[model samples]
Target chain A: MLEINHLRKTFGRLVAVDDVSFTLQRGQLLGLLGPNGAGKTTTVSMIAGIATPDSGHVLIAGRALSGDTDPAKRRIGLVPQDLALYEELTARDNLRFFGALYNLAGGALDRAIGAALELVELADRRNDRVKDFSGGMKRRLNLAAGLLHDPDILLLDEPTVGVDPQSRNAIFDNLEVLKGRGKALLYTTHYMEEAERLADRIVVIDHGRVIADDTLAGLQSRVAAAGSPPANLEAVFLTLTGRSLRD
Target chain B: MPLRPLTAMVRKDLQLFFTDRRAVIMSFAVPIAIASFFGSIFSGPRGNAKPATIAVIVVDQDESTISQAVVAGLEQDRNLKVSRTAVDDARERVRRGRTSAAILIPKGFGDAAGLAFFSGQEKPALDVLFDPSHSMEVAMVRGILTAHVMQAVSAEMFGGRRGGELVDQTLAGLDSTSMPEDRRKLLRDLLGSVQTFYRQPDRSAGGTGLRGGLTMPYTVREEAMTAGTNVAYNGYAHSFAGMGIQFLLFAMANLGIEMLLERQRGLWKRLRSAPVSRLSLLAGKTVSGTIISLMTLSVSFGFAMIVFGVRIQGSLIGFLAVSTACALMAATFGLLVAAVGRTPASARGVTTLAVLMMVMLGGAWVPTFIFPAWLQQATLVVPARWAVDGLDAMTWRGIGVRGAIAPTLVLLGFAALFAGIASMRFRWEEA
Candidate 1:
């Protein structure tokens, strides 16, 4: 549902994202697998329309996204890498604010907020200020904030960076449910196991360029074709980029 | 722009600001406390309050009628709080700063001073001891002493029983001196005239037949200048205006820092990802900042009005115009700070310095009339000056809505300038 074509972004002398191309289809969870500073977040930022690419463009639902306030932007939801929730506000208020940003209001906004909170299992603590919540709870609330409008494509950028295993599993379950509802998601992460479990197809990026893009079996076949024994996503990454995924 | 998103953003900011109790208190309470403090100092005592008096200790070594009359004259003067004490006690009191000064009348001062006045011989000096720290009061005390001594010595010479003896003694001393003929003759004529005045019938003691005893030829009529409306000057009005302007700037600076923090914390990215325009975001922040500043100024001035009788004596519309414009200017200034500073810490420090300089130059701590001519003219560039002066005009100055036009226009001009610069330099994302 989201298409990024030949996206190139540069910051002065450094190239953050170069000639990056990807397509996130309906009911597909495309894991953008890369190490730190491998342009994972930069690619996600370009697709989400927060940062403009120096060349190329992003298309949402087969329509090119135009300027800052284009209606096409409404089809995409962004769960930023950091917990972007307002700490001073209650969880419900935070959701309401984000909902209002997407033009959601009244009973419809209320129902959407309730559904998102229930999916994240934070319905009971919705009245509590986000600052008073645990780290894992805050991460869940952050995810709920992006889901308030039920966009066609959800961009999850390292959403589980500092989450506990329980919260991580919960987030993975929520993403699976979203995928079942035919919501296309572009999830970026450095954790190979998270990508291995959630992503239907994986795109391995190294140094601002995609080196491998295939399913688990297809990627293993490519590794075997290259004279290396297929082990797991890590071995696949090590063979494809000549470096460990963590490195 | 769609109002829903902009409304949401402004509501969220105001919610966050109000939820932080310390921030809310800082926005409102600090200005009121400071304004009340300054008001009490600037507002002198009200109706029927006793006027301030200087304390004086009188040490009379001469128990003569002339010395007693001088002490009585000082006692009758309403400007001095007089007390009789021994020379040692008076000296100690003055040295310890208990009294403003001490007057020591020497022995035989009445006779010696009477003889010197007529014969032009050596003059008897009255010793004045004063506290070193209160040197300024010494001049005033000396002037009062001179007036009292002149009246007492002259009245005693003209009407007292010692007059005949002193005149006969002065005449006897004049014959033995080798003086210039014309000068001696003038001195003889003056003494002879004094003797003739003493011999006149129906001359009352302690009375020169003047309307008031020891009065100046004419008295000065004091009037306070206002905005041609005869409205009384209210110190609380000026204090509230000054403190309101100063603290409103502080509130806006804080809001700017909060905006910077939002950008640093990744909230800006989330906000931009939504279908909201950049203008909506900036407008939301500006609206919230302006609302907060207006509330702060209102509470401060409201407190002044209720407790201190400060009134908006001019056109009410004029006061509101200036107030609204100043608040908008302060809000835009916050945006400017956020756009210019690279980080929250740096922005806070620089904005604080700028705000303090503006407050000082704008005469928030003191009246602008007390500022030097060049400084007063130079401070016109600071927007706070217009805000403060505008409020003053609407309050004690009692000028109408016409007086508010220039200040309101100037403040709006500053707001536009700040908004333009901030929008040009604003970074939507961190570098």
Candidate 2:
């Protein structure tokens, strides 16, 4: 459902993302695992149409994202690291606003807002202002906003950052449900356990390059063949990306 | 374009604006409070009250008829209060500020007047003492004394004249025996002309005409010529309206900065990611800003009407048309500010400084007439000035609908220019 070819972005003297390429099919949760400053957010931002890559081709549903932005944007949803909910508005209002942005209104908009809220288990607290919400509740609402549009593909950048374990588990369950419904998701995170638990195909990136790309079991089997005692995805990640401090 | 998203944005903006109590108070309450305070101070009469209170000491040394009349006349004047006291007491009173002026009438004051009347060589004069600190009161007392003497002289000269006897005597003195009937008729006509002069009152009081004494030293006549029609100008109302409009523009710009904040927070991105187009988002903000600005102007006008008695003398439609243009111009200005600025702080700083400079140059705080001639010419570049001038033309100039057309067009031009720049430079993300 999504493909990136030879993506390159530079900021003055630093090359943020260099020659990065990946592909994901329908009903697949592709984990983009990277440490800090690994250009994960930059890649996600380009795919989300928030940033322009210096040289690249981003294809979503077989349409070039750069040339046909509206169609590509329509097919994708971006859940940013920060909860982008309006603090002064209620969760329901926030969802309704985002839903209208996606051209859903009246009956359909209401239904979408209700369903998204219920999916995040925030239906009961939909009427409360986001400013009064806890960190976990706000993160859930953020996830709900992305789902309100019901796009074909969802791109999440560290969605579990700063969220509680329960909320993180709920997010993983929601991702599984989305996958079951034949939706494609590009989830970026540094936690190997999250990639092992949720990602159908794990693409480990380091220093703006894709170092390893394989299914969780396939990567573990390869590591075990190297006499690594059937190493888990964590050992495979460390072996591929290394453990250097990325500051 | 879908309006639902725009409506949502407007609703969110209003909710955020109302949630902050400090913003509400600063935006609406402060202006009303200041307007009321200034309105009250300027509500009363134009002139200020007299500060110095004068007291006059009257020494009745003569106790004569003329002296008593002079004292009574001085007592009747509101400026001077009369007090009967000895010379020593009067001097002490003057020293203590109890008395500003003192008059001494000698025992032979009536004899002196009679001698002065008959002799005409040496005139009798009264001694007047006054405190030098009260210079205005001293001058007033001197004037009163001169007037009193003049009245006494006029009464003594012409009070007992019988007009009929004088006419008869004058006729008897004419030489009728040497003249023909025709010549006698001409002489009679000449005598009639002389009689008309004597029938008129004395011209010594400097009364050239009834209106002559009513003329003031400096007369300020304000005639506002809007579209070639002369109308009475209300300077205060024009100033208030101009300032009100300029500040309303500022408030609307501030609201637009809030929109930029939403953009920074990724709210705009989230909205754009939906089915809504960029045009709808811009339209929504512009419409919302314009509506709020117009509401602010209306409320300010309401205050102006109730407090300053400002009346809209021109066509209401024309006023509204110009005001709407002004609102659009303000909104467009805000958009330009937001589109050009990369951050909310920069947007606020630039908008505030720019708006203030425009208002100052536009004659919002000060009337354009008071501005230097060159500065007034320079104000044409500022859109706020055009708005203010347009409003003044509608209200104080009473130029009707036609007067507003020019300013309205200028304001529309400004709005178009600003919106064009904003549209071209607008970006969804920080650069």
Candidate 3:
């Protein structure tokens, strides 16, 4: 449902995202695992059409995202790392606003807002201003806002950052529901456990390149054959991308 | 195209605006407070049109009839209150600003006039010493002295001539045979007219004992549409309204900065991810800013009316048209600032400086009339000036609806031009 080919982005002297490539099919949850400054955000931002790449292309539903940018944007949803909800507006009002941006209105818009809020378990608190909400609650609302238009592809950029354990689990559970409903998701995170548990296919990225691309079990098998402790995704990740300060 | 999102954005902005109580007070209450305070000061004591109080010190060195008459004249003027003092005290009063002017009558024993009449010499002068810094007071004192001197000289001449006898002697002098009949007849007519004028009682003489003539050398008659209403075209009011309009435009910049923040926070990304077009998002922000500006302007004018007793003598529709255009221009200006600025701080710095400069040049703090001729000519480019002039022409100057139409059109032109530039330059996301 989504395709990227040899994506390259450079900022003056530095190559932020270099020779990156990946693909995701329907009902599949793909995990893009990388450390800080691994160009995970730059890659995701390119897919979301927020940033333009210097070379290569992105395709959503067989339509080139770089060529037909607006159509590609319409099919994709982005849940950013930060809770980008308007603090002044109520949750329902925020949902309504975003829903309308997708040209949803009247009864249809109202129902879409209601359903999105319900899915995030924030339906009861929909009338409360986001400024009054807790950090976890705000994150949930942010996810709900992206889901309001029910796009085919969802791009989540570290959605669990700063969230409590309970809220983190809730977000994982919600992703499971989306997978069950045949939705394709591009999830980026540094948490190996999260990737191993949720990703149907894992793409371990380091220094803007896909170093390892396979199922969690297959990636672990490679590490075990190399005299590792029947390594989990974490040991494999550490083995492939050495532990060093990235700042 | 998307009513729902636009409405939602506007609602969100209003919610935030109201939540920040300080912003609310600054936007609405501050203008009213300033207007009320300034209005009271300009309206004068108890709203009565009394002259501003000025002190006058009298140095009665002569202690003669004419000097006493001058002292009495100053006291009776109502605009000036005279305080009797010694010469030293009078000089101290003038120096200390306790008195605006000091009248020093020389001790001539009422002999200066007699000497001037008999010996043909200049009279002993009344020296009116005043603070040069108080030019208005100095001018007033000079006028009063001139009138007193004229009165004393006229009375002395009339007393010496005894009216009819002097006229008869003048006619006899003109009776020489060398004089042409027509010339003698013209002289006789002139004398007869002079005698008649002297015989008639002076209309201004009964109440004050001394007649007051025109004090100011030149008269400036303000020709306005309204004939009867003595509505002075207060440059201050025009300036206040101009500044008010410009500042209101600056408030719209805050709205635009908020829009940029929304985009950075992924609100725009999410909205774009929906079936909405980028155009719709931009439109929503622009509309919201315009609406807020218009509402602010309405509230400000309402406050102006209630506090300053300002009236709009032209068509209400015309006034609204100009206001709507100005609001649109302001909103467009905000969009341009947001498009150029990468962050809220940058936007604020640029907008604040830009708006203040515009207000100053647009004659918001000072009337364009007071500006240098070249500067006044230069203000034509300022949109704020057009807005202010449109309001003044429609309301204070009583120029009617027809007179405001051209200015309203100019404002609309600015709105269109600014909106076009902003739309062309605006970007939804940071590079």
Candidate 4:
């Protein structure tokens, strides 16, 4: 379980994340949908313990991780938007390195690596350097690296952005399995279909503020009440955040 | 914080450093190549195949026979190159670094009142125009001039014609001062002994008696300050000390660039997100850099001992202590640079220039004794100076722990200062 309470972040005169708040229980997935420069990554970054919140709190089952580095950070696994794998190292070595940072060792570490690689469908190619792998294969390996530590919660930002359709579907199936295992997941994406299929609930953000947050039916009803009857999360998101170019 | 993750962090970094051929070449290979280059350049004793000749511009205003003879004597010396020039031109030449010194023999130098040997008057002074920055060169020029003066004074007092002139002049000027009876008698007897000594006849077939000329002007007696040492002022000791420490700092700063790149590449962000403390991350890089520098210095000094004939003249333990301290200073220095520069490209540029200046000011290429007084004092702030001095002491100077204490403590103090700056400024993530 994770909690982001009134989290806000600013870069000079610009507010990147303003009073954004959310909570995710075990076995639930929360899709954070936003256009470019809409603070989706900033809010997720705070939850992943990667960036400091200018104000408010990021708590792991009510334990704060805001003071630079704290032990509560071990409970969260971050799959950043960028591929964070070491290009020179094999996929297996990358997993071992990140796993060691979480204090995982011996057979438990090996088993975790094996399971993560298998789940990502890259277990057969685990010994190959990440640089030599395809974009989709590297994405799989990147996801597998974060899963090596078996964290209580996972914060994945655009996890399938550059992956092929098959790899994207594979990532979808893997998230399903992780949700079934009762792990809290925060998934951020620009793809409406992926969020529609994977997320149980969606929170739409724009310009550093959460404009709408509800279950699929609840959001559609809100959009319907706003003059036009919206059919899906795509119409709900566009109608609420506006159709103008965000940039 | 536990050491496990910190150790893992260091191991991962070292693995990356070794696997990257470019890093390997920059860190270890380049230093080896440079060491061999310096070794060959300084292959001979005193670092050159032939001794450098000191430039002497003589301003001979007194063109008497005695003054011309002194100028000729300076030309005949092996270590000096003599040329005649005006006083202003010679002074300008020395000022412009074209010459080491200028010898000014004023007017009336060879007259009876000017360094008048027979009359027992005060010796006239020859002004030496020299660059104060060129300490070794100035000392050599002064020493050569002093030797020349001693020889000329000896030659005048015991030579054929000058010897007779001295006795006549001394006996003639005896009553000019109106001294006490005892003092006058003492001076007369002393002059009488000299006259009798020069009047003696030459017995050998090839002998030149006192009036002919004194044959050997000066003789040297050599001794070692530290007896039974493996080296004695050869270029190898200075070579290893200079180039070894110089490249070690360079390699250390380059290692710090790796840490800076980590911040740019987002690896530092990922590491910070881990359960580990930020101190552990900083410590990991510091430890890794220190280890690399130590291994680099050890291999360098080891090869220098076998190939360049550099020895550990003092306690090996003391040498180890100084080496370790310097390695620590280099580690902290790299961290401080990474913190200050904050980016890979900027860190590389700033650290390279900084380390180069530190090595130059550290007296690595040139001996500290040869540096100007102010420069020598200013270079005390550079930790590499302590390292070079400490290594030289343990290798050639042979003073042992007592000599190592100062350098060791100073290096540790520098390490602390660099570490303090790093802790205050090191950033976990780019803004």
- Taking chain B only, the TM-score of every model is 0.81, 0.58, 0.71, 0.71
Candidate 2, A155-228: lDDT as tens digits:
88788988789988998999999999889999999788899899999887778888778888888886686654
What is the C-alpha DockQ of each candidate? 0.60, 0.26, 0.34, 0.44
Best by DockQ: 1
Worst 10 residues of 1 chain B by lDDT: B206-215
Residue-level lDDT tens digits of model 4 in B1-431: 77778888778777776777876676666766776776667554442335567888999998865566678788988889889989889989999989888999888675543226544566677899987778788898887776665555555566535446756677777878567778878878877887777666752233555543444655776455541533455456666777778777877787778777766666665677788877887898888888888887888788777876777888898999998998899888888888888578888888788888888888777778878899899989888889989988888777778888899899999999998998888765422
At residue A68, candidate 1 shows an lDDT of 81
Show model 2 residue runs off by greater than 4 Å: A12-14, A65-72, A218-225, A230-239, A242-244, B38-236
Winner on DockQ (1 vs 2): 1
Q: Which residue pairs in model 3 clash with each other?
A: A101-B276, A102-B275, A102-B276
What order do you get sorting by lDDT, best first? 1, 4, 2, 3
lDDT measured at residue B338 in model 2 versus the true structure, 0 to 100: 77
Model 4 over residues A1-247: C-alpha lDDT tens digits?
7888898999899999999988888999999999999998888777776677889988898888756556778778888787887888888888888888888888988999999999999889888888899988888887887788888898888999888998899899999999999999999999999998999888988999988888888888886856665678888888898899867
Native contact recovery (fnat) for each candidate is 0.72, 0.37, 0.45, 0.43
Candidate 3, residues B1-431, lDDT tens digits: the string is: 64665676666667677776776676677755664554545444332346676788888888765556567767787677778889998888788877789988889724565334322346577778888789877888787767765555444334323323444555565665365688768757876775665565663244332123223446567343341265654433554466468667767777778667876776655554454455666676677777777877778788777656677766677788778878887877777776777888778888888888887888766567868899989989998888888877766676767877887788778877776777777774322
State how far residue B267 of model 2 sits from its true place (Å).
2.0
lDDT of 2 at B139: 93
TM-score of chain A of each: 0.95, 0.95, 0.96, 0.95
Highest TM-score scorer: 1
Error of 3 at A190 (Å): 3.1
